[model samples]
Target chain A: MAAKKRKKSTAAENEIINLTNVCKAYSTGAPALKDVNLRINRGEFVFIVGDSGSGKSTLIKLLLRELTITSGYINVMGYDLSKIKHRKIPKFRRNLGVVFQDFRLLKDRNVYENVAFAQRIIQKSNKEIKRNVPSILSVVGLAGKYKAKPRQLSGGEQQRVALARALVNQPTVLLADEPTGNLDPKNSWEIMKLLEQINENGTTVIVVTHNREIVNAMQKRVVTLKKGVIISDEEKGGYIDED
Target chain B: MRISSFFYTLKQGFRNLFRNKWFTLASIATISACLFLFGLFYAIVTNFAHIVKTAQEGVAVSVFFDDGLEESRMQEIGELILKRPEVSDVRFVSAEEAWESFKAEYLGDYADGFTENPLADSAHYEVYLNDVSMQSALVTYLESLDGVRMVNRSEIVATTLTGVNALIAYVSVGIIIILFAVSVFLISNTVMIGISVRKEEINIMKYIGATDFFVRSPFVIEGILIGLIGASIPLGVIYGMYNVVMDYVTTRFTMLSTLLSFLTVDEVFRVLIPVSLGIGVGIGFLGSVATVRRHLRV
Candidate 1:
């Protein structure tokens, strides 16, 4: 029994996301991220906190390989992003899931279809999509609400649908940008709890937000950015810079 | 790449094309209008070329000889002229035969007044050419012959027919090109709007790791469907309309029908069907590619 109880150590040491001396500057403006360095191990739950213009979005975009970097190396899932050709981007992205501030669910589709959309994109069989979508929906606490549309769901439940969509692929990294930005306090805490649950299941989850209460209560690893610079990286940290 | 994904994108493209019915109809209308003009230009150009060809085919050149030229020498010159590949036939006119015919035509009742066939130097040849453009060259060649004095071909008819044929070809090609550009430009903008309408959906698809082909192919397919419908409408309309005009012209305007012939509807459609469809699909495929290339960053 003890031998059967496995350890995640083997996969955890892979360094799922690494950014060394990274720089990104837009043509119309100054540098968005300046010589930023970060390392995220597999199965780690981390929060990326920053004020506006603090490069949170740019970092997410870079990880998505949506924006071309000015300098430095980024390796995700052992793929050197700077050298990875554009043709390989789609395959690379499958290992990383992303959720936006808005729910971004297909307005025409129901919760079940939305969740299954990710699998459909990866060309999963209909039987697999049918079997997996409901199970994933139950994991997100939407077990019987598969037929419910986005407009029918509350903001928190809608975010849960989006989260279900992102997690259906069982990705290595789940990136959430302001996941609870539109939810109230109760809904925000609910989303935080769901994210915590997802992280506990061995998926490395990164949440970027300006929310203070959830950050303070979560007591997770927090990396704070100020003007595109990493000001603090703390394990078991809180909301603000108390130093 | 898989069958399920193919069906998925196919459905998406169909739904997207018809999501806003008015918008799709407007795009089709614009495409059909352009294709209609293309069809008309094709009909007019082909028929005009045929008419020009027929008119030129009827023209023959008359080569006259000098007075007191030996008949045997003129026959040798005629044989030499006949050896030219361009000359279809050369009918030698003996001086006596010319006098007899001329008297029969002009001196009808007073035929006996010309006591001695007064026509000399009438031993020439009526030269029929396979192609009218060879007339001037043949005439120049005939003038340099030993016994031939003058080569008489109505330069006005030949030059005008050639000039009009070339001008029509240039003008028709120019119009077709302009219409093609206009259709591509208009369809591209319309397709750009369609892409923008579904921009959020595309972003989500990308986030879910849809390849460039997967994301882009639907729009391209959508463009093709639009083009097919657009082309098909004008095809039916123009086919029926051309037949009606052909029937009316053949029945009522016998003079114009005899002189300037129009292609039968079947004949016109033989070329029009494929060409119009090609233009339609070409516009759609190119428009979608251009819009997606410019707008969809990934």
Candidate 2:
């Protein structure tokens, strides 16, 4: 029995994120997430899909520790989201990379600076920044456009810059919230491809997206949420039509 | 808190200041105006206090002797007066010297009118004290001595000067408190505007795993710089104005210069420099810290 318990503990330790019956309620006393239990392991690529007000953003915020859970537990990268001290939140977040839907790149800075910004936040040495930034820019296929500002780049190129920034720190997990919401189909596909590439490279990628075509075509694990409850968890799944 | 991070935050702080140039300039101007008034009042009060000190030093108690007091006994009394701790100095004026001085002053052209010394019995000891406040004590002591006829003191002058000094101190403290508040409020407003302008940038920084110290350091630095720059401008202005005013007072008001001497620029700035800079930096730091705590939740 002790050996079996050790094996189960080791399995729990291997999971990058574990949410056991987690529930989150806002000030209005309405439940945003209800009895949610899910787990994503290392190097896994998973998608969280839900309609508006379906607790998708709330789940993301919980993983980021932006919101405290109303009940149950959330463990991200081994840090308990519910019990993590306020001062340790930044250090905890450093292990996770986040990409927003709006492509939140510093407009005044160029591609190189924007990518280097992530490295700078971690206080990387100048030599490391000079080395790592260009290497990451190259990975994002924006090495030649290092001097171009955000406004000078296309929507696809800007998203790529945001991706470069998110990946520069080599985080254990990459959380992309509607990362392709503002991009065209071609750009969105390119971003999804990059995310898949990043996951294959040994980073857990959890994306919250709404593009039905991309979701169906990707053939990845899909976790569907309806009215703050997980309705489906399927392997190689597509977007479930609610209508 | 690595040295590299320190430098980075320092660079960000300067960048923030330059990015919001208008707000920076406005804050500096406000701080300068406030310090300028404070400096002006400080200079006036210091000079007033100095003049009062000189006047107090000159104040003395005139101790007259009894009729037919011998020269040896008067000398003993002078020695006794000199032994008092509050007595700074003592000058005994003989009846002959008194008559001579009186004639030299009121009877300059009628010196031959006084054939003999009519003021022979007016000999007295002028007792100079270290502090004007000790006049009452010394006066009482002198009046109680044998062969001492009367002890006359400038009580009204001492009281008025002491009152004026106290009033100046109270007013200075009150004005300084008000000015400091106004300066802090202005700096807080400027920092608030800077924060609003960079709200999006700040949000991104917070999202990107930057600590509260990492994010707040730049604004705090910006505040300190504003304070330093703001403080320095008025010191320079006051330095020049002080010299000019001193020159005008010495040359333009020659009559007043003999009775009252203003402090040299160096003497004034020796205190003003540190105080103004300290206040400037203090206000900046306080304003930035307070605004950051209130507005920047992250």
Candidate 3:
């Protein structure tokens, strides 16, 4: 019984975030989440897949403190999500990088400056930006496109620039919301490969996707939500109904 | 972040202002026209007052003694005029001395034609009154005195000067009010446009941990620079026009012997420095606060 308890304690030690009865509802009288419970472990890659309006984005937003929890406890990186101040959101966000489906690159700035903007907000030194941005650009295969503006770049290249900006500060957790939604199959696979490489470097990554092919290929722990309730939490889970 | 980023934003603000040149030109045009009109008004008021003061100084009463009046009687009348509260100074121009001066001045080379100086054989009492308006009462008082032939105080000139001075005071107050309203309207709109254009940038900056003061300072500084620029165009124009008007007044009317009453050339430049700075900095700071209050979240 002592050995069994030690194994259980070790399992608990791997958990980075634990959510208890988390619920999020909109003011317009529709429940977006209903008593949802989730656990994300340290150094784990998580793919949250669901149908439309299944509370995937809401879950990500809740974790980021962009939306407050309606009626549950969410302890992420040691801070209670419901009780966090609006001003303290950035400090929490500093530990995480968020990538959106639309590839929100600052159009007025060139690729370097676009990436530099995030670092500037965090008050990174010029020496650090000089040291890190080049390596980050190289990692995202955007070395030669530093001076190029977002308008001048192709969709794949722009997405890569966005990825570089997200990864520039070396965030511990990467939350990608349909990161390759606008990319071609070839580019999508390339981005997936890059995400896999990043995950391999010990950063916990959570990807929300509607693309079944990429979701199936990732071969990670998948949490499937249906009508704001977790229907399945499976190891090495593929697309929802694959035999 | 370092305070240098604020400087960076200021540089960006100026660059943005210049980049949008059609807007800049429109602003500059309005500013220039306003300054030009303001300068013109100032010059008119200045010259008007100068003319009035000159007329006032020149409107003295000449007390011509009766023909062959005794020197003692003339001295008594001079002493009496001097004793009056309204009189500032009294000088005596004797008939023979006055004739020789008039011969040399007005008669010129034709002085020999007059066998006798047919000018009145009288002592001219040059009377300086304390106020030009008081000259009428003073003339009445002088005429009431014994042995006084005429009291030559120009009532028409005094009345005209009083009317002009009143008009000048009214117009100055009106122009200043209009100019103030125009400047406030212009600077507020300019700052509002700037805030609208940078709405996204401001949002991103705010979210990125920039303090409220950091985000607002650049806009305030920008406003001040813009206002300074707005007022500076007029400052230069006003100074230049001051020189032109000073030279014109000095050349045309030396007898009035008046300096530029509004401002001298050097003083005009000196006054412009503070007035322009005050208008520019004050308007800029105020407009920026108003703009930021409407736009910035904090």
- Among these predictions, the greatest lDDT belongs to 2
Give TM-scores for every candidate, taking all chains together and pairing residue i with residue i.
0.85, 0.89, 0.66
lDDT of 1 by residue, B1-298 (tens): 7888889889877976866577678778988999898887788788888788778767778778887887788789888989999888789887899898998898888898667767776767888777777778888898898877888889998888879878987898789789868876777667767667667877887878988788788888887898899999999998888888888888999998987856677888998999888978888787667756654565
Model 1 interface CAPRI class: medium
lDDT of 3 at B99: 88
Docking level for model 3: incorrect
Q: What is the lDDT of residue A210 in candidate 3?
A: 85
Report how far off residue B20 is in candidate 3 (Å).
5.6
A1-243: candidate 1 lDDT, tens digit per residue: 544444444444567888999999999879899999898988899999988899999999998888878999998888888999877888988988888889899987889988988998899988899899999999889998999889999999999999999999999999999998999989888888988898999999999999988888889999998888888899988777534
lDDT of candidate 2 at residue B209, scale 0 to 100: 89
Point to the candidate with the largest TM-score: 2
For each model, chain A TM-score? 0.92, 0.97, 0.94
lDDT of 1: 0.85
Give the B-chain TM-score of model 2: 0.81
Enumerate the candidates' DockQ scores in order: 0.64, 0.65, 0.18
- Per-residue lDDT, model 3, residue B178, is 96
lDDT tens per residue, model 3, A18-114: 8899988999979999999999988888889898899999998887666788898998877787897756666777777777777777777899987
Better model by lDDT, 2 or 3?
A: 2
